[model samples]
Target: MRYGEATVTVVDPRSYMTYQPFLPEAAAGSISPRHVVVPLRRVLPKAEVLTGRVTTIDQDRKVATIAPLVGEAYELPFDYLVIAMGAVSRTFPIPGLAEQGIGMKGIEEAIGLRNHVLEQLDKADSTNDEEVRRKALTFVFVGGGFAGAETIGEVEDMARDAAKYYTNVSREDMRFILVDAADKILPEVGPKLGAYGKEHLESRGVEVYLSTSMDSCVDGHVVLKNGLEVDSSTIVWTAGVKPNPVLSRFGLPLGPRGHVDTQATLQVQGTDYIWAAGDNAQVPDVAARKAGVENAWCPPNAQHALRQARVLGDNVISGMRGFPQKEYAHANKGAVAGLGLHKGVAMIVMGKMKIKLKGRLAWYMHRSYHGFAMPTWNRKIRVFADWTLAVFLKREVVSLGAIETPREEFYEAAKPAPKVAQSAEAQLPPTRAKSEEKAKAS
Candidate 1:
């Protein structure tokens, strides 16, 4: 049943290779977006990595109907399937969200956010209109998790630096807000570190709203559940993510949160061939079981995902060749997050010891760890080059919003004419008529 190198199809809707740990750095201009993402094709050269959304699956026939980016949907048969489709940004049905706020999920969003922030600064500087300037200078970020906290921090740092170059705009005029429903931020790094992060952000003039949720962001007018109202132009939504709902359509058993149910060996429950990993699978935490927990599942993070992927790959080979499969188990390997340049927090769990770091040292550790963890040598060099060049050259602040619609301007400039040109057929030549009559007589 096994094909050569095995036809392993990793179904991720987004084709970009996301080294998510560097997203903050990318947003902050510390690293380039090009450096943060690797092409999935280059990495998974052997496997048939299909970049498309899975509309539905027939588990009995082992065929998945996929809708690719272009063209029509088609059915692909597979002997073994791996579900690593990952999670999508989660947003509640808040009024005006669709009209305004941007979510930080993929590279496009990150780059768009960076450009929008810089463009806001430009707008503030170019216009003497006080109302427009005020609106342009205000930035609001919802959710206090790693994405929200880090994105706002990096953006604030960039904006502050950029203000120095602008004659009219000053850092004092710009307002930044961080809103979260939870009382604390960065829960993965523990409570004490979360408190430290909040303080660090507040020290930089960011208004922190705890135990508050956004009611609406209609027409750039923000209404919070705490009865506060503010009119701002930029709103960022980083309010966590749920598993891709496509799993439910497959007719497979899904967990409470819509993740596929998988055994400790990373194989789908009751199936011999199918395997799941990454953010999409609810893999049992055997370590938690040994520690007397009733039922615990692996948390969805890159640290766990990378390890699970290796185990899943090995398990596929083992299952096909009649070798023993190993159970996937790993203890939490701490967490590190950069608040801004030279400011970060870290908690390392080594054996029985739990070591924590903060400030510049933690920042260094954050960069160092992620630098080594980025996919390949080519990406590692590009990231380092970005850092090296950043020391001498300023971060590119121009926003190519037009990149999405490059042809719009050209099409408008070259409008089509309504009338057609006159041809020789419109004037029946006398010589041609005579020649046709002579031929008919002959």
Candidate 2:
């Protein structure tokens, strides 16, 4: 019998889902936000996709406790389970981070942030107070990794282009600061490429502070550990991510970083009926093996996650019907990053040869790779069309800040009831008094 026929369900918390590689471009306005996200139901048509947070997993009974989006908690039973819940954004116990900073993780956050940035520019342009304008113009981004770096690059590029339309706001008056505890940015790429990316961003007037960390962002006045202080309205935090803590309740084997331990075949260790992949599993990377080393694991990235999912799907099917499973062995293809519109850095490994490219070539390579890697043809065409049209037409500068309250304007206009004119019969004054006066005159 098929797994779906024998009771199998996949639980994902968020409603807005996607492959996630196109997030940077979506934030940069290169691709529409709608094109970047794919519905979970469409992709996993066979499996039941439950929209809720998995609070607990009981491996002993092969059951998972899920809290539904609107209903009460319920138990789901399965013969075989796939744990691909993914990671959560990591945040420190900073004083005011929760109050002031925003994160880039899901599609909603990306779209909200894009609108928020443009709205800030509009607010700055209309305000006459210098203090308020400076605060509105200043943007602080914490973390120097891919999320932080790419996000800041795209937002800055869009903001710079947008400033031309604003009468008061100029690119020079606006401030963009990037803060990271590490000495370098984009460490996923090699050191040379990382250095190139930093220099490229700096040349574009982005103030990058290395070996520094954010101390506090209380009341929107950012304080850095490097003794630097800046008052800004916008703060983004994208330092890193930690595995979901709910896995610990499953009573299964877990690795040092709290990720589920899995074998090379993508099956969870000590369990034949369960499988895990993506950012939630620590599957041994046979390709990264050294001559003397016993086992090595691959890092979490879209490249690895996509391949791992395929292997996991096949292995699950094979196991359900009594067949031999295959081991996953794949080498890293290299890394590419877009700095802004026409600038990027890449390091590609083609067999034994390693090649590096920068500037416009790298930017084109980044777009081409991601364009083909996007989930479906429907999305790929939409993304390409958005970019193709962008070349000739100016970027859309309007911010629909009231997108959430789309009906508010109409509701306000319809609030008061219309006034009606009274008929002459209803308006006749004191008929009884007039009749009494006429009787006295008679």
Candidate 3:
């Protein structure tokens, strides 16, 4: 209510906004699935929330089309539009990827992955066939960024714990492979920390493949360009993300890379009424610009997105009234990545002094930063509680994979039996047909 006269509406496909940084913990069962998300309605009580996909935006008419989950499409008009729809996972034309590969983008995927990994263990333990067991034990991950590295790290940790309960399966039997075309992993933490992360995974028996590419994974047979082939039941793809494709549908000026073009003030270029931010907007790196660097753009990460959202919101309010809009400008504080429980890396920049940290201390730092940064007090308390409980309890490794297809058993049991042909007389009540025939004869 800063302006007191303006109304805001938030339209998104999901009712809640997912905090993606904790996806690895969720997948590893270190955190509850529900704790990683903030319900938009709960957080944005002043704004109107529309749970649906925005198919098209007609800026000329100031109306956009919304396709809801269980209703006909409708048009919504607005005086100003903010395109912060964010980005989606970028994938190439690799065969069988869409069919076989699991992603680590949302809460559902994290839960599904946890269940899937545990289910694979169950299968390996129960199976008698050597090939089946081998396939079930093999896990392949594409991409070595924060999503890929932390995911494999946390998941491997969880799997090792689960193996203690399995009779036939052990951590030795499970193969974890992380493949990336880049020469190093965790590039955000600089070279030293990235190499440390790689060595750490290697020490844990994870096969880290650098300067390699997956050729194809047709029918679960992963073929790499480096002449390595493996049959893995679990294939995770976390390569990277591109701007949301829906941006093209909106008649707005987009950058060469498909992000909506926006000025330093977070206002869409060439238009005063439109504003955009986050991954979908090509925001200028204000810190870089001040250092006399040319062609600098903000990196698409949680840190930037969170800050940009606040700045964008303020700019929107200022733009509505006749107030000067503040330009978004902030120097990089640092970067942090958690690798499973007590392992992590961090870089903190304070003026000219640069501090690098690794191992358990860095892990604690990572948790503290993100715990407070998590949107609402409700989520912060829940996340903190999960971390506090982890000190005394082990990670839960149970799988509910059946949740994906819950109605399968019901469908099988409730299936209609084969129809049998019955004579017309057999359809009649007992003796009714005979009485009717006798009456006809009389």
Candidate 4:
């Protein structure tokens, strides 16, 4: 029945779907990196999984051009289309941003961030240069959304715990600055919870800057619009995300902001068989509209994306057959964010009642909710195990930045090619060479 009866092909450069909610914890080393992603092949065995990119789609001919990892590109034909390319980090043309800023988009970035933060502590503790030490200990995070707030919080917690292992490095020796153009951070949790989050971070000695933005990060020098200048070695960019630009090439009706326009039913506005969801689709909030709210749209969060996927899939099956399509409508359950260990903010909506929580209880709720929400039982168990193990074990704070360029050390130690050696006769004088040969023969 469902998608099994019809042929399905999934094209993506990555073979797994990354559970992005756990990325902050993964970067903080609270969860294993391997457990934060679900393998696509294992999850979708019925579909033909291709580890490549769908470069273009020909809706008229019903063909898609795919560029594989290690081969020439090819065209794939399909009947019903599902556009779920997702989104990429939104960035700007800020000076030196591309060269110096670190992102928090994927698992690889999380791993790199962990290593980099720990390595900064190591460098600060060992260096005699005060300038270098100060720069090493300073961290700047831009954006105050879930990604920025949670990441800085978790990373700060990690660095604080990691400081104990070093002789000279301590919490006071480090500086963490958070910047957001918005008036409050974590706006999804409501203004009260957002204020609580800001105060919580500040009480823990983090510098919170609201209504401020970074002007430039050129040459490791951070210049803020409010006239704050500092040299920071670690600059984290988690501003926001925009829909993948590739969607523009898909020949579909798109919204003003470049998202594919779709009805509440999750089907593309004009197309009958094609469907799009997740961060790439501009889906109207039907549930909100019925509540008398106007121009409401689903936020680009995992909470809405997961629900939309289910609706889109059902709509696809209904289109394949002659059944009617159901419109997707669900109110937001709530929002929970983990700041550091034993610290967070949450707002839970049960039917018509809304409950607000903060501090240790909120942190627990954050972990519990995200742990259960992680895709697959295997990952769920592994994430819980990682947390349980942390209770009895000390935090691992070693920097293995070599993992990025794994073969660099080998290249440095490798010997050069052997030089050609001349024969003894060739080295001898012209007259003595033949004479010495004749004597040796005799």
The candidate scoring highest on TM-score is 4
Model 4, 96-120: lDDT tens digits are 8998899998999999999999989
Flag the better candidate by lDDT, 1 or 3.
3
lDDT by candidate, in order shown: 0.88, 0.86, 0.92, 0.93
Give the clashing pairs for model 1.
none
lDDT comparing candidate 4 with the true structure: 0.93
Task: For candidate 1, write residues 1-442 as lDDT tens digits.
Answer: 3446556677667776888777777777788888889888888787677788889888889898989988999998888777888888888999999889898878878888888888898889899899999999999999999889988888899898888889999999999999999999999999999999999999999999999999999999999999989889999999998998878888877898899999999988888888899998999998878878879999988889999989988898899888988999988889999898788999999977889899999988887888888999999999988878987898766667777688999998898966877665555588887787798999
TM-score of 4: 0.96
Q: Tell me each candidate's TM-score.
A: 0.91, 0.90, 0.94, 0.96
Query: For residues 1-442, could you state the per-residue lDDT of candidate 3 as single tens digits?
Result: 4556878889998999999999999999888999999999999988899989899988789999999998899999999889988888989999999999999888999999999999999999999999999999999999999999999999999999999999999999999999999999999989999999999999999999999989899888999878999999999999988999888888889999999999999999998889988889999999989989899999899888888889988988888777898899878889999999899999998987879999999998999999999999999999999989998987777899889999999999999987998988889987899898899999
251-296 in candidate 2: lDDT tens per residue? Answer: 7789998999999998888889988898988988888774234667
Error of 1 at 26 (Å): 1.6
After superposition of all CA atoms, the RMSD between model 2 and the true structure is 4.1
Question: What's the residue-level lDDT of 137 in candidate 3?
Answer: 96
Q: What clash count does candidate 3 reach?
A: 0
